[model samples]
Target: MKLTQIDKVYGKKHVLKNVTLEFPAGKITVMVGPSGSGKSTILRSLNLLVTPESGQYDFNGHQIDFSQKLSSKEKLAIRRETGMVFQDYNLFPHKTVLNNVIEGPTQVLKMGRKQASELARELLAKVGMADYGDVYPNELSGGQAQRVAIARALAMKPQYLLLDEPTSALDPELELSVLKVLLQLAHEKQSMVLITHNMAFAKQIADKIVFIEEGQVIYDGGPEEFFSADNPNGRIKNFIASMTMENLR
Candidate 1:
């Protein structure tokens, strides 16, 4: 998926500014920046959860210009190809964990309930939630709900998985569990675009790194060069240092 010259605004706040980015297939592209720097906006744009007010979005061979309105089918087509995992673990409060994971496959993809249940259980097991399938979101801890959310997203079999801080809310122990799942996914070469404040974790999994600052792509390149000590861009180096320092504290 690729975005070219995208611009997004919310009321008076200009969140994304002429941002252009690309997520190569089978690679983990980690997006990092300060809060409200449009990292989340850019990630959501890939799944069309947040549409740009202008410019273009391209997925596979399909190109969508901001000027052209999209029908429900078109929107669903794009969204189906990309699954988004929100930071808040947006599970249905009324639904059990198993039902939450199976809802998409059964309702949207039209898979049979038995098949969907099988798939959901498989994904739940993958995310270390095999035993919690019958539980509700409220009954689970933050990490458990997040893992269930990951399982729910995976159940769709999306080509590209978009995650917004999958571990930001969890305590260190809980965070480690989610990180292990993500690391396993990364090892399998899943096509992922993640927005994370965890610099150390980002460095471990990123194949490509995009640094956004004040709603602009400050840098877009490999993790090595961006994280190098000799990286000439002081701003880039300082941002990493600042984030690292914050993490230390």
Candidate 2:
């Protein structure tokens, strides 16, 4: 995916200012920054949840013309290719875990109920939640809830996945569980744009890292180039130092 000269504004404040970056296909790209740095906003704009005021989004070699108005059908087409996972597990309270995973496939994609159930079971197993399909979201820990959310996102067979702070809500032990599942996905060659503070995880799993500050990308490079102390970008160095301190504490 490529973002060219992208610009977004909220009321009077400019959130994304002419940002341009290219995300290689079929690679894990992690976005890291301090809080309120617009990392999530950049992800949201890619799926059109937050429309850009100006600029273009290109996906799979097709340039998304944000300048022209999109029809409902066009919007749905883009959404079908992208899936988003939020920090909060947005599962339906009344639905069982199995049902929560299958609901979108059955309702949105019009898959047969039986087929959706089979797919749901397969995805649940993939996320290490095969035994919890019958359980309710409230019965699971925060990490489990997030795993179920991941299963739900994968059910749509999205070409790209957007994750916003996937482990921030979990305890240390639970955070590892969630991170493990993400690492598994990366190994399976899933293309993802992840917004996270876990520098260690990023270094291990991300093929590329994009550092954002004040709604613009300040550094974009491979893990080696980014983590090197000799790097000249002060913002990148300081951000890495802050994350390291947070992890140490």
Candidate 3:
């Protein structure tokens, strides 16, 4: 997926400024930055949660011009190609885990109950939540809820998965559980764009690292070169160092 010359504005505030990014298929690209730096906005824009004011977006044979208003069919097509997971898991409170997972496939995709239920169970099992299918979302822990959320997103079989702070609400130990699942997905060559403050996690799993600050991208490169001694991007280096120190505290 590629986005070119993207720009976003909220009244007088410029949230994203001329942003261009490439998300290589079958690899993980991580976006990290201080809060409110437009990282989530970029992720949201990819799936059109928040449309950019101007840009070119290309994904899986569909190309969109942000300058023009998209028809309903165009919007649905774009959404069908991408799946998004939010920070809070965003599960339906009254729905059982099985129901939540099957809702997308049965409703939007017009899948039959038996097939969607079978897929939902398989996905829940994949995420280690097979036994919790009948339970409500409020009954699960943060990590468990997030896993269910992931399963729900994967049920759509989207071309790409977009995650915003997937594990931010969990404790360090709990975060590892979610991270382990994500690492497994990475190994399976799932294409994803992740936004997180976990520098260590980014270093461990990111195929490409993107650093955004003040509504602009400051660094975009491979992990090895990004942390190498010879690299001269002081802002990113300093940011990583500070995050590391905080993690230790």
Give lDDT per model, in order. 0.91, 0.89, 0.92
Badly placed stretches (over 4 Å) of model 3 are 246-249
- RMSD to true structure for each model, in Å: 1.5, 1.6, 1.4
What are the per-model numbers of colliding residue pairs? 0, 0, 0
What TM-score goes with each of the models?
0.96, 0.96, 0.97
Best prediction by lDDT: 3
> Residue by residue across 150-210, what tens digits does model 3's lDDT show?
9999999988999999999999887888899899999999999999889889989999999
lDDT of 1 by residue, 1-249 (tens): 889999999999898899888899999999999998999989888888888899898897778998678777878998888989988999999999999999999999999999999999999999999999889899999989999998899888989999999899889899888888988998998899999988899999999999998899999999999999999999988899898894366
> What's the lDDT for residue 66 in model 3?
96
Which pairs of residues collide in model 2?
Answer: none
Predicted candidate 2, C-alpha RMSD? 1.6
- Candidate structures ordered by lDDT, highest first: 3, 1, 2
Which pairs clash in the backbone of model 3? none
Best-fitting candidate, scored by TM-score: 3
